[model samples]
Target: MGKKLWYHSSCLLLFCILCTNSFAQVKPADFKYVDHILGYWRMPTKHSTFTELWVKKDDHTWEGKTHRITGRDSVEMDNMQLVRSGNELVFTIAAVADPKSGKPVPFKVTVLQSNGFVAENPACDYPQKIVYKWKKEDELDVHFKGVKEKTFSEIILEYKRK
Candidate 1:
């Protein structure tokens, strides 16, 4: 009985720490200036490259396009929308692989950072989490990871401003 109680107590403590440190909500002042995410970013690998374009549409809306580049051609791989509603940021993505992308799914931002944010769809089939990290003014790192096929995996992409 003592061993089980200890284990449960430890798990609860860890959960509290993770919840406090990993998630953030945008305040009015912070969401007021998300234009930093607007622009172009490219990630190049030996085999292929990924590119993203973010455009500000207004005070509360943005559009993003992601492409896969090999050789010289760029193929659109994902279309996304970033919207700020009140104090929350919403992400809607249309991925080429999702047949139901005709009606995109909305993922709300759960972790808001100084320069980037993470949005998630816990109901998704594969990559349920998406994270964008700004390493520098000209560098962005993106992570796509979650439980897929009952296995946890992550894909990291490093991007530089173009």
Candidate 2:
């Protein structure tokens, strides 16, 4: 009787684990909407040119990096990832010199559309909200908003496909 009980408990545990893992995995169809963002995007400023390169790592994950180029020097500013976590998509960013030991900060994607999406992380110190909009086939607009110096601030970046 004890042996049977132990076996049932083990089986239940295994079933629970399997269910959790299955639910956590992202489906490939859910990731297809973000496919259009894969490519090289460039935004030139007066002092430097900012570039973002995005590539798909797998059906469930996309990786990206931002770089600032001034003269002959190119410096990586941040690393980004778009991944499916369960039924939802998460956008993560890790600055090269982040104050929190460069840990990746996660922003939950709240709005997803054919042309763009919005991700928000209210707990983040800066850029609590991130917005991406496609202006045209070759143009993209990105906006970051948060509080800085005790005042609300927002920065907009316009990029062209390169």
Candidate 3:
């Protein structure tokens, strides 16, 4: 009787442990993935350098600043916004701000996020696309399509943790 009771107690303890281990824990929405993308990313190619500022806003929206820097010339800004649509991520550029004018002009572009981060530019007659690939080392690989071959350089844009 003593041996049977001990065995029954061990089985009960094992059952409890198995049940706890099988239960899946829920992850919070504002977790690691979203946090990683929220910062300044510097993209450097053989030809030029560019920096993008990703600012998180209310309602899962992001304000972005795309700036191109060349030689001694000042930064040229492209103002844009990003919002998640369904399972895909969507980006809309409000305008391409000219340094000379210092004004925001009408401009728009949309990109569908794929397995890798892809931007689809369908507004123009020719389709322009941008793909952002992540490396194992935590660097972002950027590729531009429908543009000049040599002109489109490979850049590793890395995010700085805040």
Highest TM-score among the candidates is held by which one?
A: 1
The TM-score ranking, best first, is: 1, 2, 3
Report the candidate with higher TM-score, 1 versus 3.
1
TM-score of predicted structure 1: 0.77
Worst lDDT 10-window in candidate 1? 96-105
| TM-score, candidate number 2 | 0.76
What ranking of all candidate models by lDDT puts the best one first? 2, 1, 3
Worst 10 residues of 3 by lDDT: 106-115
Candidate 1: where is the Cα deviation over 4 Å?
A: 1-24, 96-101
Error in Å for residue 139 of model 3? 1.2
Q: Write the per-residue lDDT of candidate 2 for residues 1-162, one digit (tens) a residue.
A: 999999999999999999875755444454676887899999999999999999999977989999999999999998889998767898888751247576778887877767877888888888888888898988999899999779999999899999
lDDT of 2: 0.84
Candidate models: Cα lDDT each: 0.82, 0.84, 0.53
Off by over 4 Å in 3: 1-35, 45-48, 69-73, 85-88, 94-115, 121-123, 147-162
